[model samples]
Target chain A: MSVTTPTGFRAAGVTAGLKASGRPDVALVVNDGPSHAAAAVFTANRVEAAPVTWSRVAVADGRLDAVILNSGGANACTGPEGFADTHATAEHVAGALGVSSGDVLVCSTGLIGERLDMPVLLGGVDAAVAALSDTGGPDAATAIMTTDTVAKEVLVEGDGWCIGGMAKGAGMLAPSLATMLVVLTTDAALTAPELERALREACRLSFDRLDSDGCMSTNDTVALLSSGAASAQVDEAQFTDALTRACRDLAMQLLADAEGSHHDITIEVVGAATEDDALSVGRAVARNNLFKCAVFGGDPNWGRILAAVGTTDAAFDPRTLDVSINGVQVCRAMGVGDDRSGVDLSGRTVHVLVELHAGSEAATVWTNDLTHDYVHENSAYST
Target chain B: MSVTTPTGFRAAGVTAGLKASGRPDVALVVNDGPSHAAAAVFTANRVEAAPVTWSRVAVADGRLDAVILNSGGANACTGPEGFADTHATAEHVAGALGVSSGDVLVCSTGLIGERLDMPVLLGGVDAAVAALSDTGGPDAATAIMTTDTVAKEVLVEGDGWCIGGMAKGAGMLAPSLATMLVVLTTDAALTAPELERALREACRLSFDRLDSDGCMSTNDTVALLSSGAASAQVDEAQFTDALTRACRDLAMQLLADAEGSHHDITIEVVGAATEDDALSVGRAVARNNLFKCAVFGGDPNWGRILAAVGTTDAAFDPRTLDVSINGVQVCRAMGVGDDRSGVDLSGRTVHVLVELHAGSEAATVWTNDLTHDYVHENSAYST
Candidate 1:
């Protein structure tokens, strides 16, 4: 259940003195391969972090030798000076690994608008490189955590190759990615283009559908590194399926540990005029603070669901909408249907289904219920 | 200061037994004048309340002899039966006033997806009409509250003419209107068309720009009635200005009494490419949960503001953006400027300024901080 579960990968995690808690804060993952093919997706937010800007160009040629990540300061909104810091960090890692700086990708997560401590961060990077081992995946996963309470890792085995992945993000989870950093390593015989296509499709279905708090981040990165050591030349469809499953697993782990969340909600929107309409309706409901709060209180308040759907321009007749909570059809034909008291919400997982009665297309989005702890955690997050 | 502050208007409030707490839940306002001209705006949500649909048509011809409002049930999402209830309510009011049913407007607020008790509501309406008085403005304001903590009323005096207004909404305040129900009255002489134009402009600059929680409601209405009793024949521009001032004053009251809020935040976006751009930017910041939480914690986290501004498509160079919390310029040129410690946010009101440096346009939006109490109130609201 770690990145080193795959062949041709070495990883390490070390303390960086950047965090006030004195925990491990720097990680390094290197692909030792006869084939170094890579693909990545960064935050769509225009005001991106310095590391995102640097890594986007590093992975553009579909190749990378190593990835260096730190968790303490996000290095975002720091202007040119911040960008220069990221460049220097990459250069330092490249020198330690004997690889070109252009082949090294960097990722950072933590409070935004602050610069990283260069001397301390550089010392940690040197220590991480020295401690690199094939079984260091779990350590690396633990190092890249900011608010995450647990380390998220997954492994998917194919015919002759396997994929290993790790993710770190607890808050600011939203569409177009959250404040997350995900790294996937695989020992499969796939080219750069194939890996890119598979990674994009997998992320679109997994991470893109999770909106914990509707807060987009400035430093979201998901990178896939392929080392063709298995020499299995697997089918593209099969590879894509395995990659998607791994991503979904990590996404669920993130949802389970979202900041101050009480319930994990899966909103399924069906019978829409189009898939986009279904997604639009689902996202609108998922982002509604009132609906989330209702779920947190263990109340089957289907009225708030319909009101949220009404705000979207999705194709749906107001009078024909139907809503079900946890298998209880609380609302039908836009009015009260079954007894809301029959619905059971005294659990951590909840399912909300909305039928638009427009068409056959459908989509689903995942979210977390708003709770008092959410407000408390976020209120003093930067302080 | 309320709807009855103006000449030729009488209002009353009475218990309807609609609320479980036995609070006054019915209100009536009568325009007893030689000229009855009115205009109104309803929520933009597609699945609007039954009363909104009824009042939209009743005020289409720019004439309203009376306005009836009720709390404890929104009368929304109840299908045809809900529409029938609103129609019957208008007819009852019309019968009491000896006027056409189309000349009476109805408004309802409270929980959605529930039917109102017609017998109890109608009895309260009769009592309210019989108890109508010239000094009943404060009582009428109190009667129309759902979760509001206090009555909101304002009066703006002009040249022998005055505009009086009242509003009630504690949560679900958003753009395109909130869960608010507002009533305005004026004795200034003006035509229906003129009243419509002025009311729209006044609402656009006042209530429309206040977004306390970013949750649009299905039952929002702002109605203005002119009795033309003072015979002032006021200037159109002056009347519009006074009306806007009254709306803004009531809006501030709503902001001050928002549900479970700790701080009232005013976000001002300047140097935008267009007025719409400024508004979009301001609304994005106002709606960001992280930024709202930062304000609640009294942490001057300006990076969250920049991250929110980056999410919008507004034309602005990311490198040139500036953000100020309270009066401290915490961020300049997209990077750290003044020390965040220099900023002060221990007050109940906060001012955030963002300069785009893209053009010469500006806009402002009002919101409230995200606090634990907000989550608590909303989570258990309908439970």
Candidate 2:
């Protein structure tokens, strides 16, 4: 009941013989609604996947009857042939559901530069459509796994309506979205414009702040579909809040299950001149591989943090900056403060707070420690 | 006979007890010059090391009598105490040579945010001064090693004069100067201004282009000292060419021995609207950890390369871009082309060429493949 936990929605997951592991690889979510209101966000990368290109046009009219996603062989860099494959997949889904082809969005993930196995994929689509049920949300969430260790699902109930979402990503996760595939379902009576506004706001504060590996994917996509079948008229602020909470919850799941990560680290940057400054500073620190490795080693090396911070253009004089690891103020006034030996990083969760002493704005960036296993996993991945 | 390959220079390397391994950790190079003309470049990082701050001021007059460098402690983020330590070390060198303290430059590398051991450091300075000899260049190069597996040294003769240099860096190497310490000596008769222009031009094409790990160190410094002993007023172009060759040689050496790197990768971006655009594109691909890891796995993953190139503001149409690995044009016209299986990556060198199809400019960035050894070395370093 993940996606269909809300009224007037159904989802299904089925094996598509796309993943080498023989796991479920095809997922579908549908809306039987009096109103079809939708919004979507895609990867900012210019070299986008064929599915992303198709879905961008499909969801342009702010209505989507269904979304078909597959886990293997991202149709990216496959030229004209890739786009044709996406179109064909959407057409098949439309024919099965008796909906217009233009109202069906297709999403594909996995290895880039390869075309999908159309026969296997189309067969899985038929099975998914047949298996679609109100309790199929968890299965749909499991179908999109690449390197993800676990399925990610979230539900946030508003005053009278609810929003449910499922996300899948483990690596190639960065701001502006990760190598992720997400689908959201809601029963709130809102227009497409309202859903779009709420989605942008929700992602700006949630998915847009995670920079796990600083690698953007070509197949990143997030879509929202509202059925309005519950007849629950929700206010804009309340809907936005619920969406943000759902996205944030899924984002945390992505962080917690990042491949080969030994520790989940949160960098909270405060006293920034602006929110962008805070985000920029946090991202610089988040992408610093050396700092991530130090954290993986459980070494409270605040100097690495300062070195990373100094690389950013954020407002703050080097002499006035401060850094605290866990609860220990390891560095103050940009110099050695309390003894670092007192800081214990034996836990899996690490919190780093950086004070810029420039303004009142603040932001947090979530990331994972770079570990030897991460190097090993990634080094042997495609080979 | 590295730095001393050119006339009128003496150097020495001595153990300072600063390194736990008891290896040589102190180096000194003195310009026994009839003409004290010099040029230098330091790290662009705002949070510079104490030695970098001190050396900047010392080299401002364009005349340096000697340069002293140490390993085992970076002497950065130690605040006033660290700066004072750098000053004291310079004064000790100045006193030993009877030169002005203002003319003595200093450089240090190793762990950051730690104060140097003044007693052992000063003792090593005395020994270095006592042991200085024209043939001590090789030792001086060896003493500067941090994680470097081999000492980098090069000699190139121009006209009647000659230039010789040494460099040390195994990680944290990037543009705006690699995380390195380099000392160059020449016997050419040139003024400070001329040397400055030539040095900057040479470095801009060599050391300033390598982005090994995309981590900038706070203690990077490169210096060139002329003794005017050979009195060879060679053509400026000839001198610049020789200097650039020497610098490039050392840069390659640094790249070959990068920490835990199994492959020396070169990313060449061509057909950009401007040289800067080409450089921006190349640097983006070079710094992409996922692309680097893919290369380590011997995977011809051109999509990762394109994804990284898209992050840059370089002029290029996504649909017209092309990527080639080794001699195989795996991606043509932004789509799949030749069979990637034809590409052989069994060698230690990997070349990735990207054709932007935007204009007539091109640039190359050298990097290293990301591997588990790199993660292990860095993660266990500070701890």
The candidate scoring highest on lDDT is 1
* Per-model chain A TM: 0.99, 0.98
- Model 2 complex DockQ against the native: 0.75
Off by over 4 Å in 1: none
What lDDT score is found at residue A363 in candidate 1? Answer: 94
| Shift of residue A32 alpha carbon in model 1, Å | 0.5
lDDT of 2 by residue, B1-383 (tens): 39999999999999989999999999999999987899999998888888888999999989999999999899988888889999999999999999999999999999987778999999999999999999999999999999999999999988789999999999989888899999999999888898889999999999999999888888889999999999657777888888999999999999999999999998898899999999998988888888888888888888899889888888889999899999899998878988988899889999999999999999999999988888888888877
lDDT of 2 by residue, A1-383 (tens): 37888888989999989988899999999998977999999999988989999999999999999999999888899999889999999999999999998999899988888778999999999999999998889999999888888899999988788998999999888988866998999999899999999999999999999999999989899999999987767899989988999999999999999889989999999999999999998998899888898888888888888888888888888888889999899888877888888888899999999999999999999999998778777766665
How well does candidate 1 score on lDDT at residue A316? 81
Provide the DockQ value for model 1: 0.81
Compared with the true structure, what per-residue lDDT tens digits does model 1 show for residues B20-74? 9999999999999878999999999998989999999999999999999999999
- Looking at model 2, the pairs that clash are none
List the candidates' TM-scores in order. Answer: 0.99, 0.99
List where candidate 2 sits over 4 angstroms from the true fold: none
| Candidate with best DockQ | 1
